[model samples]
Target: MLADPMVLILMYFVLPVWLIAGFADWLCHRATHIESTTGAKESLIHLLMFVEVGIPLLAAMFLEVNALVIAVMIVAFFVHEATAMWDVRYATTARTVGPIEQHIHSFLEMIPLMGLVSVVSLHWGQFLALFGTGTERARFDLAWKQEQLPVTYVAIVMLVIALFELLPYVEEFFRGLRANAGRLVPAKARRREAGDTAIR
Candidate 1:
């Protein structure tokens, strides 16, 4: 399957989409952090990204190309689109996205569909084959014989994006924890410690 031209084409096409979208998301997240927003919309957008990339990657690696898989992709696509629209609405209404940022957001929103199309085109034959007689049942078997490289590459890309989205939150969480720890400690205890140090 890796030898197939369609597969090769999709493999190449998906990389830029992954990079561009991931970068846009990272930029938006950085802005959100800098502005110190509530992060509700940012959180949802990242969650949607995880779902959009994660499910398809897993399905391509582990599951057979079949009607059920296509159905799942369709559902996931719609859900992602819905969340994406909501994200845009929230950002625009909240004035979180500025003029320059809107261009990045537009590109981020548009390119995912091309990625989806690439996946579907690569599996188009299998999808058509399912419509033939006696092939309607779901296939849960692993696609070890299929082209695993694209799936692996996509998985790595998603992992990178996941890290980009998560690292800031992780840092913020630890910082908050440390600050709260300080706040929880008694002021009298801190002052006593400080006094003991001064005396020493």
Candidate 2:
């Protein structure tokens, strides 16, 4: 499995590209000052999309690539697509999504599909068995990879995800929340200011 070009693409190319794209997307959000405009609501949506893709990603990394895993990947890709649409629609309403961000969004959207295709290619027999047409039998049981990925590589990936993807987004959410909180003015304070103005 390790020597296969498809697996190589998945491990060396697809994974790194996806991580880079995710970090780039986060930078785009920061550049647009999403915290001030769309606020935490938009940040929340971003986190949701992260989880949608993250689940299948983790599955593929650790679990055996079987019918169940392929099915999860396919379903997740569609769900991510729907969430991406929602994110753009909501984001455009309140923030400026410039050309750079738009391009980054394109990467963010397509990388998962690319990864899914590679996975299906690597596990073609299982994928075909999914629809009952393949020579191989479909296995849906959840089991770890027979030969696990190198510990150092998995550690690096997890660190990158936490530092680049997860932490940055979580910080973005808090920034949005704090910005929104600061904008809130009490009705009583407003009325008091209004009365004072009348007296002047």
Candidate 3:
């Protein structure tokens, strides 16, 4: 039920914190001049990570939180983590991933896990069903939430996501693309350029 404390925390607290962290991460990227350093490749990786996490998040918001949904959330979290590591590895090859960005990254990485824990706690029965330890059979079929979140609230959240998270990243990608233009230099090449420029 939406009134449940765990659900409330996941919906209001966890979700907002995640969004804020996401926007903050974008700010960090801009501050570090991601367009000039990491370029569009890194921006693409960012969009990939967003979708990896977004699919399960949308499902959780719109669908029933059953064994199948819980399973999806768990899987998505792991996939997102892997992608995050890839993102950082590639990024650090080209730019300085400073402490502020690293701190923002910590929140981005862990908030999904925290939200998953909250969801599992709220649907303990369904989570147990996934492990075959519950009284009810595990539900793998997707179904709409019986008690839906308010339409206005969902709309507002979606608007915030598009405005704050999605659009800004999209713009970042284009900025990188425009800056790179015809340049297809590798990360190592770019780093070498920076080093050579420093030497001169």
Candidate 4:
């Protein structure tokens, strides 16, 4: 399998894609505050993209290779790409994305396309073979093939991006909690403290 040219192509492109996606995500977070603009909605969309892409890619590494898996991956990939394109348009038109941010967005958009191309190239034969088989050929099973190290590495990078995307909402949750706590404090105690301060 390592001898396959498509496998080699995927191995080569995976790292660059992970690095570019991470950096572009950081740039986006830096360019806009989550609560102030469309950042929250955009981030949520990104989270979906991560789930769709990362999960299938990871599964493909360990699962039995089959036509059904390839079909699922193809569908997932297209959905991921669509969300990514929507993210770019949403970021650019719905909010004020800076020149640097726009550049980052454009580059980020290409990473998935390249990845899809590589994956499709790698599995093209299998996909075509599926069509030739009868309906009874459809089966999902784990082949327990040795894990692809690159898939794991990419998943880790995406996890970091997930954390970064989540941080803003986490902060907002705590801020709201604190605000509610303050409101619940005893008003009489606050007035007593104020009187003590005046007496000093």
Candidate rank order under lDDT = 3, 2, 4, 1
Model 3 scores a TM of 0.91
Query: In order, what is each prediction's RMSD in angstroms?
Result: 11.3, 7.6, 3.1, 11.7
The Cα local distance difference test for each model comes to 0.55, 0.83, 0.86, 0.56
Clashing pairs in 3: none
What tens digits encode model 3's per-residue C-alpha lDDT throughout 1-200? Answer: 87888888888899999999999999988987888777888888999999998999999999999999999999999999999988887777667788898998999999999999888988889999999997988999989999999999899999999999999999988888888883533344366433231111
lDDT of 1 by residue, 20-52 (tens): 655665565555442233234344455556667
| Residue pairs whose backbone atoms clash in candidate 1 | none
TM-score of each: 0.64, 0.89, 0.91, 0.62
Candidate 4's residue-wise lDDT over 21-66, tens digit each? 5556655554554233343455556566767766666665556566
Comparing candidate 2 with candidate 3, which one achieves the higher TM-score? 3
**List of clashing residue pairs for candidate 2:** none
Model 2, 136-171: lDDT tens digits are: 999999999998988998999999999999999999
Task: Assess candidate 1 and give its lDDT.
Answer: 0.55
Residue ranges of candidate 1 with Cα displaced over 4 Å: 32-35, 129-147, 150-159, 165-200
Residue 140 of model 4, lDDT score: 56
Off by over 4 Å in 2: 182-200
Query: What value of lDDT does candidate 2 attain over all alpha carbons?
Result: 0.83
- Model 4 lDDT, residue 127, Cα: 64
